[model samples]
Target: MNKNLRQTDQPLRQILTKPEVSSRMTKWAVELAEHDIGYRSRTAIKAQALADFLVEGASLAMTGQDSPPSGERSGEPWILFVDGASSKEGSGAGLLLISPTGEELTYALRFDFPASNTEAGLADSPPDGYNRGQSQERSQLVVLQVRGEYEAKEDVMKKYLAKVREVIALFDIFEIERVSISQNKRADALSKLASSSFAHLSKEVLVEVVKQKSIDQVQVLAIDSSATWMTSLMNFLNSGVLPGDKTEAYRLQFRAAKYAYAGGTLYRRSYLSPWLKCMTPEEGDYVLREVHEGLCAAHVGSRVLAKKCLLLGYYWPSVFQDAAALVQKCRACQVHAPLCHQPARKMVPIHSPWPFAQWGIDLLDPFPRAPGRYEYLEVAIDYFTKWMEAEPLATISGRQFRISSGET
Candidate 1:
């Protein structure tokens, strides 16, 4: 018999392996020897099979059979899940962007200003989703109007719709779909977290504060292709061309004298220092961000930061303005700025109707250790009479306190 069959032959197995057997058992053992059977302890086949099955299932779960292959193509679609959350404290949203390669990008947005009907849509639009996403009926998502099923009657919505269309036009392929909130829990949690506080947020999540409405802003054109403030100065140095207007041409001439152009770079003349490199407002803004938020930055005040940049030998017409704007937009500077210690309510002045009518009372201090060992001092001052009285006590008692104040 095979080794597999020998183990299951229980009737023969019982006595086959035993050395000291009775005649009857030995007879049976000898009879079983013809089949080449042997005996060993039985294993729990059912239980072991079950355990192995469970281990295989767990491994399959970890490997994620439903997940798409990592071999990515250039045109693979990106999946973005967004949810908007707002509270009386503030408005914010959460966004989860999943790349085709399975990389997840998480973001929490805090709206700096209070959200209005139109603004609320923008507030939530940062993270809101639909199909598997949104508040469905009452949702103000920008894509909601673009879906064409819903109409945006408000001017702001129209403007937003136009802006959304403009942005979508930039992409070669773009699609919007709805998703239920349950399917987008990560985005929903992020939105709520942003509405509360960012201090307790997870390290993997990025937090951003939106200070202005997107509709109010214009698109930024390329500086090189468009007219810049440096255009006039550049014209005078390169080709000696001036504006037709005498007044403007004269001003341009004066400004051009202070600047020198060579090797395709602009430089400004300085009395005690070497020629300082001149930059456009856009370039200056970048430098300001580096100096104020870079490794060496202490996040100093805007004015101080601008002065430091000047000392570093660079100049721009809107240098100060750019520095101030950058500082104002800095998340760290705004969050950690000096707090006002003043009371929230306005202070009211106490008025006295007449002298000695009523007195203002206060504890002058913890009772001084005087010769009498007074440990508490209760002072009373007449608001109108300007008279004062004080009582010192080594130990305080309700009865003593009333008597000392002449309340009895």
Candidate 2:
């Protein structure tokens, strides 16, 4: 019995030592051995079997899966999952491609603009071909699975969808399916990760994303010879010659003395102040909006708005006027302004010829009951002298008025 068992163990050891099987199974066995010492050998055997199954699947994809005849059915399908997310910070798209052999490749993109889901989908289409390269030509079937409705409703979305369809038309076979968000969690997570503040990607990964330029900066940098104001300033500064009237020429000369151009930017200089950034009309508007109503702005009044722009070292000919106009048009200020309490009309005084010539009398009623059952009082005053007389009464009537007036 012992000899028979040894013979069987020898055959098993020889089978495990075979080069073709050992090369593939060695790494799997070594990894499984780290955690489960008691069952390491068994686990290694199981892992090796699983790896063989995967290899078989891949081999089948390469050999048996041939493209169908022209105008007939297509080859095995490649699976694609897509998702998009938008946040206050930015927008992002995620795509996962599963090859015929079940190998998965993930891709993520971050957008500077607040992109809609449809836009993200449109943005994702071109990258698929770029990543697949020549393989896309051989791929006969391509199925795209998204987490929401595939229909394009908005005009912008329709344009994006049309582009996506154009991209899809390049492939011989294409299909689109709408799946639940939960089913597409991996792609969804990738999108959220791209949109998140903490997703710090390497420069190589972010090379394709375009950085956003500030409206003020873009308008300022867009200044060229075609811009009349900028051209006049540039010519005046460069040659000391003015193009218009003498008064305008003198004004330009004076301004040219105060202003200078460096690296394509116009700057104003003064002995007492720091260099002020001179801006065009559009740039001025952007500065006013950012200064008066940006994230840290307090919605200051017109004069203060202009002062704020000046303090921030920005200058334009119509800075004050533009600030005033922007403040006047501000809906927040209009909706939240405080009520006014000042009198609208002027007051005139009444004069009396004598002390008692013009007397004003009034009756006070419903006072707390005092001594002698008095509940009402009649008061009289002389307008000129500002003198007063008062008498209390238990009852108020015509007879009481006559007694109070000393007419009885």
lDDT of 2 by residue, 1-408 (tens): 122213232333444444356687666555543442221222235888889999999998977668553223434566778777778878877767776556787777777776766566555663333222211211111122221344445765555556566676676656565566676887777777787753576443332352442221243456454464667887667666576698888777776877888877888886888888888889899989998889998998999999889889998888889988998899998888787788798778898987688878899888999999999989998899889999899998998988888841
Supply the TM-score for candidate 2: 0.37
Candidate 2, position 119, lDDT: 61
Q: In candidate 2, what residue range of length 10 has the lowest lDDT sum? A: 133-142
Q: After superposing candidate 1, which stretches have Cα over 4 Å from the reference? A: 1-75, 116-144, 219-408
Instruction: Tell me the TM-score of each prediction against the true structure.
Output: 0.37, 0.37
Model 2: residue 121 alpha-carbon error in angstroms? 18
Tens-digit lDDT track of model 1 for 155-238:
877776776666556555567766775777887788788877766877778888888877777778876578778788988999
Worst 10 residues of 1 by lDDT: 128-137
Best by lDDT: 1
Candidate 2, which segments miss by more than 4 Å at Cα?
1-228, 343-408
